[model samples]
Target chain A: MKIALLASTTLDMLPSLADALARAHGLSLEWYVASFGQYEREVLDPASGARQFAPDVVLLSIDADTAARDAKSFRALASQALVSFPTATIFVHNLVLTAPDVLSLLEWNEPESNARMVAQLNLELSGVALGSDRLRVLDLDRVVRSLGIQAVCSPRFSYLGKIPFNKLGLQAIAGQLVTAINAYRGARRKVLVLDLDGTLWGGVLGEDGIEGLRLSNDGEGKAFYDFQQLLLKLWRSGILLTICSKNDEWLGLEAIRTLRFMVLHDEHFAAHRINWEPKATNIAELAEELQLGLDSFVFLDDSAEERALVRAALPEVLTPDLPKDPSEYPTFLMGLNCFETLKLSTEDRGRGALYVQERRRRYEAMGAVSLEEHLESLQTRVRIRAAHPSEFGRVAQLTQRTNQFNTTGIRRTVDELRSLADVDGWQVLVCEASDRFGDYGLVGSALVAQSADGPIVEGFLLSCRVLGRGVEEAFVAATESLVHPGRGVLLRFVSTNRNAVALKKLVELGFVLDEKTGLFGRVAPMELPKWIELETVSL
Target chain B: MPHDNIFPRIQACIVDSLKIEPGRVTQETRQEDLEEWDSIGHLTIVLSVEAEFDASFQMEDIPGMTSVAILTQHVEASGSV
Candidate 1:
């Protein structure tokens, strides 16, 4: 990530903050910190450091004093940022009042206090950014309040070099800024694998029985109930929930089925592995069933032993500590930044329904004698066509979230996807899958461009729910038929930590890897598997 | 606190906070002698020493306290650690 730091005050604390943020997000940050008082000249000039830096993200930090002095100029900076770099996303920090007591005393009997004026200035700045897609307002006031205003600022540093924030304060700002960047770029975690017993409810299901379990009604049960309600809200907003519990399957089922006060039932969870096996094992199996990366999971268990074991075995899974008291669990879980996203697409809203459909398909596969017979029974149909204007948001979302089966793992925003769709030769094909179980809405997408050599595939990905049913081969064959005859298909396979399944599938389908470019390609007469009945149509 | 024992602990805090070499941050090291020990670095070292010793200093005393020997003396003079 390339970031250009533009601040009215000294930028002495950003490097340390950037180091911590970079390490946490598994990203490298190449930063360019411009000299103080250069925000205007650097942004306005055509050949200034802002343009020459060409950063992916630009962070503008200005103090409350400057904002109060000229509110119009403060809000104008966001527009200037957008006009300067049309593609780059700019993060402007909202003003934090350094000396509220003095401001309150000086602005007495006025319509609004100086602090209120600064608040209004921040609101107006946010209003400006709200009208533009490439600009965002970062709440420095929230950062100040959360980290404590006194601890975040140092009088000595401010007096010495006009540095506004201390080390911890700068770190808090960097943390929030990186989260905003992740939300913008679509690198958010997807699944929440919650534990049972002390995690979900107040007591053990086997010991307490269905009627005896404390859930959501009285005293201590209200906390558990509230947490369940929170999880349901996440579920409704498109977060997949699963269970990994060490208990009798029937007992767990009885608790979920008979607990009338529980907000979530057996049907709410996408999958559950309830047995005596280690939670680490069950979590891995749940990831396989859901076809999500371990990095995308957050494991919540009340047992310190269980949390430690999972942390040791699967370091990628985020295991947040739970206080011994059940009352604090809800607030603790709400504070986690594990599951954060800027926008929710249609596919996200329908994700729980799609998982339910997959469960039915799994049951159907269990009874079938052979793999071919199982697929034949499902009556699967994959519709390959150009991405429509209505599905642009979902297409962009799929590019961001579909990591396990993504070939290149290249994420695109809605505007970028729309521009690509408008191009003459670029065809963004969205795959809609349906079967006997149900309709899995917008399960796959591929971006292909007509090159001189042939049609070069920029990206190809399928949802895990639609995989294992010959959808991969069917989608590929449909894509091959879309291209002009006698022209070969060039496939690009960019390896990531979690896309091995995609790479393996491509290699199995006779796509040979080019040693030089590290991309996969196959020529004409690419064979399509007989089991798949594929169809292609123009949008 | 004994004045003799404060030198190594202050040196450790300086080395750790500034990310400087361990043995090189001796009692003789001054703010002007090192490149990273600029205005901000000086503040960081002072704040870090305050935090490490659980002490506080006035804003006026910070600019004068630059060297390891002088900073250690200032921290001891705060008398709270």
Candidate 2:
């Protein structure tokens, strides 16, 4: 990934140091550092090297004095960068206040004080981040605040090379930025499988019963309470929770249901396997049930032996070594660098309820007489239209993330998607779906192009949440109505390891394989499933 | 291996920061004697020495203290370190 590092000061060593820092954490990023104090020029001039680099991520590390004196310019620069590079996520820095700013205690509280100005600047910077999904604040003030500004700054070096901080301080800044970058790149762990005994609470359920277990707002149980609080936050942030415990089913379920301080109840978990079985087996079963790959799992167990068993059995699953003291659990979990996500969309925040709905939907499937009737019972409504400019962010995210249901398997950045839509004869169809259960927001995308032969489905994909509800067929129908592929609609698809799910029902969808061109084409128009109600959202 | 002797540690800091040969730095060795010891390298050496000895150098003491002996003398005089 290309990363452009533009700073207000002479940070000649930052690019190398930041790249080394990222490499240390298993991320490979190519750095393009602009010349000293050329941040504005680089952003304003379209032909500048940084602009020509066409980076995926940009880190603008502005100096404190510049930030305090004039934040509006920086905000303007950020906006300019947004227009300059549509694909990139711009992370602008918050000014790191040194001792000089707060040295005069009498003037510290003054309205025009440097401290007040920078604080206001940071708030404005945060607003800049909130302005768009692609923009974020690098938040260097957090590091400087934690480690006092006196320790981080070097006046000698500042005078010499226009660089402010020492090597240690620079590394800390780099670490924070890289974490934000990783989160933006969607490298967050997807699931957290936890042990119920001595992990979620202080005591084993079978041994001590629900009354004896420690979990409360205060006292010795506070540790467990705090741990649960963090776990619940992660669940809300879109990490699926599950229990992989070696305990009887009823005992665990009963304790979770009736416990006053149970932050995560049975409804909170997407899946649970509470039988007295090997935890690795239980976790694998939960992964299968959730339809998530094994690699996205992070298993937590209080017992070192259980952690070792899961670690050895399933090397793909991340099993962090447990600290014996339960008091250290919350802080230890806080120290782990696994749970970081950049964008929290409506779909993401409600993902826990969505997956829980999946379990209920499966139960509904079992209750229904047939698959067709089950589909009818779903009552899914799909809104499809030309992809709006505002939705390109989610569309790009879907293209990168949606693998199982994606045909062609080609990932496009927002810049490429915009260019595609701008071309003379192309259409970018976006679909949002809802059912009797809930809304599967912005679940599908299809990129179509007019070729010499006919309309081509350049790339098509649907979110797996809407998979069984006939949303894909409805999305295709909406696309066909727009394209009017007379000879037939042809799709450009090449098989990948994870994309076989996209190709399975192509023939049933009226597409025949042209083995010679390796394309799927249908001479007849696609029929939208009767169960799915399609509406064209005139954009 | 030795305790209460900050001289060798100060020499090591200079060598490490400047990337000089081990024997190139002596008690009397000055910045002019080493090819790698430029003005920027001098500040880098001070920064490393600051980290090594857990001491912050006075800005006035940096420019004149070019020799290894002067650097070591400052470290020894900063009794808390």
Candidate 3:
């Protein structure tokens, strides 16, 4: 990753800390740190080194004093950064007051104290980057609040090198910077597979009945109650919740639903396996049923033995140690940066509700006379169209999340898709599907382009929620009409371990693979099922 | 606290911070002896020593305390360690 650092203060000591943090997360950062007082020439001039470097990310850090004195100029420079680094994801540091004491004395909207100026300027910077996917706040204020204000600044270092952060402060800022970088790379865990016994409440549910579990609105139970509150926030933010416990299914579900102080219920979890089976086995079953990879799971259990078993059985799953005390659970869970996601669409906010709708679909499936009859009865429709700038977020999200039914496992950020939209013969296709149950909003995307050999299907993927209803066949057939049709339409497949089902669908659609060339070719568009009504537009 | 035994402990901290070998440093080692312990690394060494010994040095005393022998004396003077 290329990171260009621009700061009003000297950043001589920051790169070593930042580089070490990046390396720990398997990222090698190529950094360009500009000299002092050259922000104008470095960003605006065409021939400057920063402009030529064309970074993947830009970090702008300005101290509280400099920002307070020239708030207007810094805000203008931040706005220009969007135009300057057209494709780069820009990060602007929010100013922080150096001293913690006297913070309560400052009045709102008053610029007399440096604390008030810093707070007002930070709010304005947020206003500038509102609703923008490329521009983001690095949030230095949050870091300073966590570490005490005095811990972040050193007068000796500031005098010697104009650097604002001390050693501890540099470590904290570097850790947060890497979190933003990992978020940009789409390296986020999707599912929180939690264990129940002593984790959710104080006592084991089997040993102590649901009435005896220490979960209430106050006292020792307040610790567990507060822990559930944070987990509820994660559920609302689109993290899939699941249960893997060693208890009776009926009893566990009773405690989760009937308790007065319980913040989560059966509807919040996408799925669960509350049986006496080993947790690792149950987690693998959940992964298979959800059609998600094991790498996207985070397992939390109070028992050290359960955590150790999951870690040994599935090395891909992230199992962090749980503190012996449950009161520290909320703080520990909040400190984890694995749940970071950049953009949340409508589909994200209603994800848990969508799973509830899926249960209804499953019940409807069981009542049908046959598999073919059930699919046709659902009334599935597939719509493929030219992707607009607004739908790019959903399209990029599908590329990052889909694993099993993908033709080519390619990941593209929203910024990458924006740059690709300008090419003459390239098509970014948004595939939205729906049935009688509910709407699956923008579930798939395909990358098709008019190459010298003709239109080639470069990338294709769909959400597992919309899998079994001839959607993949409909998507491939629709791509044929997208490019010039006279030449033979071609598709490429690179086999991944999870994508064997994709190859079966391709062969079923009459695409024959040439052994010598390793390319799948079809002279005409394949036939779609009568149940699939494809809506397409020619480029 | 006995001040005589703290020199080797301070030397270990400096070697660990600079990622250097321990054999090259004695009680008399200074900043000029190693290429990695330049001006910027001087700050790293000072921070490591402060953290290791639980002492705080004022700005004026940092530049003059360039050797393990001098740093041990400063660590004694800060008196918190």
Candidate 4:
């Protein structure tokens, strides 16, 4: 992706940022340094060859207040850039609140600078991001706070001392900028696998009973409760939630059921293995249940022992350390930008409900004596929908969270997915499953990227709750039928840490395994079983 | 532990702060003789000497703190016992 950066002031920190950007694998950046402090007609020329380079992404680091005051010129500059490079993803940074010394210059005695400045900055940022479908706004406030520095303050600038800006913090921000750029160019992780005990709650369920669990009421358990609520929100935002616990199953269930203080119900977790088994095994089971690969799973655990076990056992799992204190849980979890930094979509809001409905279906299937009886009793409904603006968010969320049944196990951001929806050869399908109990929201998602080989299943995933009821087979059959007619089309099942369960279906579909590579491939005539009804919508 | 030998110890501070080869730090060696002796590096020398000799150098003393001889004098005047 070709990127251009526009700065309003001298980027004293650009050297470090340039270094970081250089290290980024697939990005080519062309920096257009425009210092608002030294605005000149020659420097701001819109018709210059620099603007004609046609960047895929543009960063506007100019201060909002300054831009607003010189709106005509700034807008002209922005307009020229937009017109010259029509499809560029424009990013506008919010103005940082000045320090006390800087604020003291203003006439108002108010502790904070004029609300007008802050409001204008937010307004301009929103305007740009909303005005252009390709534009995005990076929250400078969040970035400043994450750096543990007051963004507005000069911090006693001394040329000899370390640079005024926090080096580590700026590096993180730069890294996120790079991630956002990559996501705009189509690269994002799909699933978030979380550890249960110290990560999700304030205390361990086995050690601290449900009554003793530190979850919020009004104040006492506020931090833990707030963190759970945040996770719930993330799940709804389309990040898949899986549990890998090394605890007694009954105890874990009792805590979720009996703990009045608990905020996350059984439904919040899409797939969980709460046995005393090593976390790696549980994580594997989770991946299998969710139909995701180990490569896509980001594991969070407070215990170093469990984290080490998973890190050693499954090297592909991205394990971010869980901060020791419960208070830092929310901040720590949110800092992991693997799934959070991407644009939010509608599919995300309905994700929690989908997972909940999936769990309800699983509960209903419990203790069914025969496979036929369970299949018949499921009363499952698979709703396939064409890619629509309304379903884009949930579709993006499903793309991110669905793992176990996933074919290639790739994830994409909503923006990227939307762009793909327009591409001629690609087919993006979302599968929402529900039973007699309720709506499963969006239980499955499939993406077929057309290639010379055939319509390759780039992603195939089903919510774990809907796993056992022939949903995987039914969904695959429907997907194949949609793409392949009369003739047999090849299906690829790439083995992953979690999708072992899908291995059976791969073989059952008559896919042959390469003795050396273990990559299963086969050609099978696609047929949806008569009992299952498949509904689909085309874009 | 002779109190008068603090001058040699101050020289040692210069050598460590400047990250120069021990023998390269001479009494007349200017700041340019050492590569790491930038503005921040100079402040580090003052801080290290102050800690080693239990003395404090004034802001004015910081600029004249170019070589080992000048730095040693500043340290001694500040009452390094």
lDDT by residue (B38-63, candidate 4, tens digit) is 76567556656755775655655567
Between prediction 1 and prediction 3, which has the larger TM-score? 3
Q: How does chain B score by TM in each prediction?
A: 0.89, 0.85, 0.88, 0.80
Q: For candidate 4, what is the total of clashing residue pairs?
A: 22
Error of 3 at A81 (Å): 1.1
Model 2 misplacement above 4 A: A24-27, A45-47, A71-75, A83-87, A100-104, A148-151, A325-331, A423-426, A507-510, A527-530, A536-539, B1-81
Estimate, for each residue in A1-539, the C-alpha lDDT of model 2 and write its tens digit.
89898988766556655677688768898878888778889899989999999998988888878866676786577778888887788888877777474448855667778777777777877886787877887768888877778778888778866768886777677778778877776666788998988899998788788898989999988888888888899889878898888888988889899987888987788889999888888888987788777888999999999889999999999999979888888777756767876677666788788888888888889999988999999888999988878787678778777778888777776657777888555788889888898776888888888888678888898877777567767777677666773345778887877788788866567778888977788767667778888897654
How do the candidates rank by DockQ, highest first?
A: 1, 3, 2, 4
Q: Which ten residues in a row have the lowest lDDT in candidate 4 chain A?
A: A151-160
Q: Encode model 3's per-residue lDDT on A382-405: one tens digit a residue.
A: 898778888888788877878887
Every model's TM-score: 0.85, 0.86, 0.92, 0.67
lDDT (tens digit, per residue) of candidate 2 on B27-75: 7788889978877678777776777877776778877778887887787
Residue lDDT tens for model 1, A139-168: 788889987888888766788778777666
Identify the leading candidate in terms of TM-score.
Answer: 3
Candidate 1 CAPRI assessment class: acceptable
Error of 2 at A195 (Å): 2.0
lDDT: which candidate is best?
3
Q: Any residue pairs clashing in model 3, and if so which? A: none
Let me know the TM-score candidate 2 reaches against the reference structure.
0.86
DockQ metric, candidate 1: 0.42
Q: Across residues B1-81, which tens digit of lDDT does each residue of candidate 1 receive?
A: 476788888987778667789877887889888887876677777766876787767878888988988887787788854
lDDT (0 to 1) per candidate: 0.80, 0.80, 0.82, 0.64
* DockQ of each two-chain model: 0.42, 0.29, 0.40, 0.09
